[model samples]
Target: MLARSLEARGAEDRTDCVSFPRIELRLGKQRYWPQVLTCKLFRWPDLRHLSQLKRLCICGRCGRSPADSITVCCDPYHFSRLCEPETPPPPYSRLSPSNHWKTIDEPTEHDTARQLRRNEPSNSQNQDWPDSSALPSVTRDEHWCSVAYWEYRTRVGRLYTVCEPSVSIFCDLPRGTGFCLAHLHADGRHEMVRRTRGKIGGGILLSKEGDGVWAYNRSEHPVFASSPTLVRGHARGLTVHKVLPGYSLKVFDYQRAQALQRAMGPELPDGPFDPHSVRISFAKGWGPSYSRQFITSCPCWLEILLNNC
Candidate 1:
């Protein structure tokens, strides 16, 4: 009865009208009907028809409104189920090893405020050092700050902020413990100041703990007397004596490295060297390739060894 009804609907005249045969024929040649359909439906659909099918999906992880015509939650793992079998994975995994994993060795959580350690040698180790009164104070205070997960950008295409840490909200975080210094762009110069907080982790500013009674030093980084702004009911600013020595090299080490390289010439390797590898591998097997005379003297080459430790 169904066949008769289909036949009566024009029988021979409607033979070409049957879409399944045409689809099978195209598919026999490995043609992608569903992809063609999707591209037609999405990329070139009439605006009136397109508007009816368009939808906005929010990412479960990020709460972002993805493109109107695309499936929002189509994770790479589930792509096979999202469309007909012919569609391949999105040609790229943003998290793939070749791309994002190349620089995974470096840390994203850069403590910009950390200073160099005082005990570490600023000059050669054998040289006589100045007394405690003669040497300068290298300490700096840490302040607490955490960004909400929603606040961080999805992708950073630029150099500086490319490796920034992901932020998340923590309700039960510890109160009044951890602190790190951050350099904020103010006035003309990058001034160093100490800040404290009621909460330990996460990047939110709080108020100063005490009244505006802080000491000033003649030889240290300029101390600021003003109070920082607050978030919630907490004070984010406190007076810290010194940041670690690691933070100290962040400012001036690059310039010093370039100067040392020019003076040493090709006698030393052009850049930082792995001292442990030189000590273990080169000391045993390779001689001319990794020589001892060049390895010990170069400070820039030596520091990478120190940094590795």
Candidate 2:
């Protein structure tokens, strides 16, 4: 049997319908080995030898971008830091079924008051912030919020919220445990795509008091907190603001309740210097390009969206 086969691949399949091949990546060290594999294969030619070992070099791996692999979950998604020049968004007819562009619920004075009362002083481990579990249930708590998933307009001025139901539900989660994030696919499904370990992991906790949320700098490095907010007036969309790490930020105050600490995790282990490969292979293309896959585990909000509430 043929171990693997090649098919027509590009940004799209041979027929050009979305084709997201499941990158059957068994982590051999690099963090996002799968998606990074796809990028190295289909996207670019910028990967040095894994750990700069000249014996197992690129001549054995370079330009070998495979097309077909394990059956995929859905179509591939292209994430660009650069927002595409505004284009017309999909009309209502072509839009996904779960999308709704609703304004985020802002905390009223009364709600904030209630949250403060519910979070009355106690023998909490962190005195500055109350325990997340002490607050009332989701239906009753003002601070019970989830990360809202939105599909923003690429060409037009609009954002469609597909899934925002269950991210921040921490009832079953362990107090100190951390979970990872997934990409909220356009089809109302989620696929794991980001990192969730090291200094920071998966998501943060929102304390009911002050409509407040606390982020931990679990990583040794500094992380910038980022939240997606609605632009004032007719803009009818979201913009992100970066908040520094080791602090608390107001939730419900932004379009999305969660934020991401923008740091690319601990550095990849610098392998023993192999002079032959260090001078040629590692120097040839993208040098040590692991951190670029994602800044944090699951990009925060999207990570929560993919969770079981």
Candidate 3:
């Protein structure tokens, strides 16, 4: 391909020239989990032209710049010039036989069950949860009604589907000491928030001042949050806010309260102060994994539904 490219150019080119056909690789039936490395090249016209002063044929086509581009990521052999290592696969467990593989086709029943089983609880939550009847009955006068709740989006603890089903609910939150939920620990202790693994953090505290909720990044790493009531509303669908460590974001969207407000509680007459239905998602890194994260929400306002309002 390089010889053909140079032949096609015919002469030394000064411009940032690049060409490649669409490349696809097929590895029999089980190729999905294997790492497919593609080297990325940058065409820095000025630098290569300068390097040409040494009479070096760095470039294959024009001999101006090197034909190879510096790689910034993912190609395992990238670290060194000659001694490159092999790219590894996902994990022994994730690999499946042809019969077990589920691509664009319908998943078999075993596949579905295997997928769902990944998000089960990890550690243990305190036993003293209020009964369903007690949740809706709690009043503004009671402190419990003032708090919010979070429910894991996927039964398999979607952040890392290969892991066990993690913690389900967090209850009895006080006005202060906002809880921090994160995926910091590498070992088994990741269930501090809700018994899940590989998740971002959220240190959520109810606003002492107003209906607002103040969220801080108590974890070592950064966290992202988003909601329909948030600045980048979910009407556009799945936007995000990056909340750095120690920093906080004021999250109170009374504007889009008509639909979500019903879940918050009947404190106001459908005007301001949307209830606990604030649904947001978090992840350790907002990559493809972000979509898999638990779509957690404040369960505090579930009382409104329990009241049959």
Candidate 4:
């Protein structure tokens, strides 16, 4: 039966439609279709039945259901298994911030004193740091309900505000998408974002659904995301997630951020820390799992600064 099926053109021959005879074989208490059994015997040894696979007509033309004169093709090459890519595990185990801090080697007292002394400025040296009081205050525009804004860092930095509920960012879109950045000037540092012209299919789509923000990956290459709300319960170390093409992930949760803010209290840390900010890299990932330690090391990336979250 296997030899005859192999020799038979099946659907490969464009002129005529060849159909394999329906045969059922029983082994112990199990019954199997001849076509499915043949497929498992030669091509996919692990494939169970037609339910786990999709059949494609090799002749390049066939409808979902054939007419009375047309026959179904049973060629093993015409079938493909349906499956999704597995997500990689986080870099660190379930260790809280305090516990994770304890794992690191503490600095020596002398080293700490030396570092403090090095940071301290001398009276004779003129301070290069800009005075906070001298800078003008920025106020938000009341015209639109701004949820978030993207900060792009290329040869020169540019900011694009998101006033609408949903927005699409792309390099080159023929239809003139939500926020087209193709005409924007860039240098060698922004080459990765510029390469999405004709090579990659589409760009990312961000939508404000309910209290959370969702990011849909429509591009050919995967997008990497790192958000405070997404890594709430995890360790202090950065956690970067790889979002595959045609997949959507909830990048930010407003309720979770509020709860986290309440737990943290009014006292803020001396170091720069923004609980509502999110970072996404295009076509590249950075974190403990990857060679790049920080998102700044990525070629093309977006910094999403959220408001009133």
Candidate 5:
């Protein structure tokens, strides 16, 4: 209501402004979408003092922005100008009543089923997978069980959910190679020796020439045992899963592992050893069992691995 607003501002001398109450429109008991267009006048010749008046309102149909509209009255002719474009409803679909007026009859259930069948797969056998029991069990002495088992934290595979049902597991060897369970166990000891700089908490080194020892206070063994899931194989290649409670574990493809080794090159020892066979070991359970094992042992092993790498 520009007129009312002007009057309220003591500027009745300007042009007229009025808005009627909201009007509702319905079509066949259903309300159709509406679009509103409003215009505003920034200043009027006679209402120069009330130029600062700012009143913005929307229309019943579409909520158009007429906030900065300005109305102008030049002599006998009146003109209204709005800056924003008026958005209208999208065009009707080509299959509307106008195009298919006689097709309102519902299709029979048989007809619908026929159409669905026509587009369905020809054989159910094409989509069915062999049962898990039929699938080969992951070998216990697989090489991937070594490093891949430790890196299982970052493996790519289906996330298990009780509410949802699915089946997925990996059992193939990695591209280059993977460490076996025995190798992983033996290497874990090497990791401990390298990490503690030949002084694993209780001061024991694997070798006089080697840095630290894995059997420092008997804490590292449990840690290594807890991370024995690498024995599980993937149909494709090795896949690791992060099961540690607090620590975020990740599995790595060969490329990622190499990249990580390169990134850590600065910290690596000058040995000819490659980190490819070394995998991370995580403790089991949320209690002190997993934490104490990993915390005490991993650093020792990590230090060992770093030195050998």
Candidate 6:
């Protein structure tokens, strides 16, 4: 069975489509289709029918070419299941107030009271400047207003404050950056560097924009990210999003965080959950889809702890 599976996979890799010998699969009295069985075995185990999956254009046998007689491809990787669409919030009302008119000679008591208050010194105007003691003293790091910081497995780095709009996090780039993980002497830094020496070309760029933090994947490999903002709708499981090279994604959304904060509860997944922190793994993805289950298990992963988020 293993040999046949391997042969089928090899043939599929070489060509656009490859067929396997038909085998009858049954549970009790009910029989399952070959396509459904293949999808369940390879793609999504919870997948029940072939209708749940959509074939990719790369699959030559799957309705792309008019000349081709084959309509379906049993290749599980060539098909992807549809995801539930997110519903947007309702629109606000635009109803205006009723208009009123009055004669120039008819001055009401309300108008006289308003003019009296307007001429009088207001409470705020009376206090021209606040007392020096009332104001909070600025610390050395106050200039940088650090919203977040990065961390390895156990070793934590300095607070990632940004005087500028954005900052670049790299491994061994010559240019200056806000934070350089390559200089840090973490436990698995050497191993991660060794594994992704040449592949870690141009690390990711993090920018603090309006109401959100964006992560641009400048590296060659994909970057996996998981945060409260990212997994706001998914209450049952943690959702890890993969950002391909050159692609950018909002890792942290303040507006979404505020909305989820009130509804969020203590019930979480098996691993440790830091509601204010975001975990990003470089080159490797660690989640339900990948071999590594958590970000800690990843060779090179970063934990971004947000402040006043």
Highest-scoring model, lDDT: 6
Which consecutive 10 residues in model 2 have the weakest lDDT in total?
Answer: 275-284
lDDT of 2 by residue, 1-309 (tens): 011111322111112223344544555665444434444454234533222111100011212233434432221122101111121122211123433322212111221212222421100000122222122234422323333221211111112222311222111222322222222233423223122122233233223322233332222223322223222222222222222222222322211223211221243112211111000000011101222222211222221111111
* Candidate 3 global Cα RMSD: 22.5
Per-residue alpha-carbon lDDT of candidate 6 for residues 1-309, written as tens digits (9 for 90 to 100)? 433433453222223454544554687886666666776876467777644554432345533332343333466544444321221111111112321111011111212212222331100000011111111233444442342222323434554565544566777545445566666554544565458545555566665545466666656677767666664333344456666654456677667777666666564333333455566777776544456655555666665655555
Off by over 4 Å in 4: 1-157, 188-201, 232-234, 267-270
Q: Write one digit per residue (lDDT tens) for candidate 3, span 179-215.
A: 3223222222225334322233223222211223334
131 Cα displacement, candidate 3 (Å): 38
* Residue-level lDDT for 52 in candidate 2: 13
How do these models rank on TM-score, best leading?
Answer: 4, 6, 3, 2, 5, 1
Backbone clash count for every predicted candidate, in the order shown:
34, 10, 14, 0, 40, 0
Q: After superposing candidate 2, which stretches have Cα over 4 Å from the reference?
A: 1-175, 178-203, 210-218, 221-236, 254-309
- What's the CA error at residue 109 for candidate 2, in Å? 35
- lDDT computed for candidate 4: 0.47
Candidate 5 structure quality by residue, lDDT tens digits, 1-309: 444443333111223434333343354764421112121233333222112121211111112233323322121111111111111112211234433211111112221212222431110000011111111222333312111222211221121111101111112212212121222332234443344323211111111101111111111212221111111221111212222111111111233344445555565322222333323233321212233322222332221121121
Please give the distance, in angstroms, between residue 275's alpha carbon in candidate 2 and its true position after superposition. 54
Give candidate 4's error at residue 295 in angstroms: 0.6
- What are the models' TM-scores? 0.14, 0.24, 0.30, 0.51, 0.17, 0.48
TM-score of 3: 0.30
Ranking of models by lDDT: 6, 4, 3, 2, 5, 1
- Sequence-dependent TM-score of model 6: 0.48
- lDDT, candidate 4, 102-196, per-residue tens: 11111112122122134311110000111111111223452121222222322233446675555666664444356555555544434554553
TM-score of 5: 0.17
